[model samples]
Target: MDRTELFLAIIAYTLIVQTFGGKAEGAMLPLFVLLFALPIYVVVHLYRNPSLE
Candidate 1:
């Protein structure tokens, strides 16, 4: 999938299931925030390090 689609799917899946495939459910909020922030963080990191591409 494209980057945006992949990111959205990750967020949707994370929000949809607190446990995520019955593996665990100890830290929902932190997992959600990390899931949601990952894309933004990637963009910001890319902006800061354009030459890495």
Candidate 2:
């Protein structure tokens, strides 16, 4: 259970809940954006600052 695995698990759970929870029409869109953007942001940030780990 590394950081990537945990991040993916969280994204999977969020997508499952959003798909099955029966919310409004466009409610999950922001969550979808966040889920997609977050990894990219993390990757870019890590690339710029490689001293994190």
Candidate 3:
């Protein structure tokens, strides 16, 4: 996905996490880190893919 799509995914995931897991579980550092890093990984993956436009 592109950055905008990834960002929206993160937002939706946050909402889902908060709705189901509630406040305390939603603040877990690991989850937050993964959420933030997702876009970085996407960018890196695109850069590394020689075939992509």
Candidate 4:
């Protein structure tokens, strides 16, 4: 997929996960890592410089 399709796919995925993820205990790990921990880590890690991008 190209960038636009890939971006929309990710947005759809995140919307589903955020909307229904908390209804089940089994979803907690992925929900936490993907929605919380990973974004925070990425922002902090790239705050200085994201040259790798």
Q: Which model scores highest in lDDT?
A: 2
For candidate 3, write residues 1-53 as lDDT tens digits: 98677667767776677778856574455457767897888789888995766
RMSD for all candidates, in order, please: 5.7, 4.4, 4.8, 5.6
The lowest-lDDT stretch of 10 consecutive residues in candidate 4 is: 24-33
- Candidate 4 residue 3 C-alpha distance from true site, Å: 0.5
Model 4, backbone clash pairs (residues 3+ apart or across chains), number: 0
Q: Model 1: per-residue lDDT, tens digit, 1-53?
A: 88678757766666667545665464366556766788889899999998875
TM-score per candidate: 0.44, 0.54, 0.43, 0.41
RMSD of 2: 4.4
Name the regions of candidate 1 deviating beyond 4 angstroms: 1-26
- How many clashes in each candidate? 0, 0, 0, 0
For residue 23, model 4's alpha carbon misses the true position, in angstroms, by 7.6
Candidate 2 local lDDT, 1-53, one digit each (tens):
98678767766767787778887446556567767988899999999999987
Q: List the residue pairs that clash in candidate 2.
A: none
The lDDT values for all models are 0.69, 0.74, 0.71, 0.63
Writing each residue's lDDT as its tens digit, candidate 4 over 1-53 gives 97457545655666677677776454345545555755776788798787767
Error of 2 at 25 (Å): 2.3
| RMSD value for candidate 1 | 5.7
Candidate 4: pairs in clash:
none
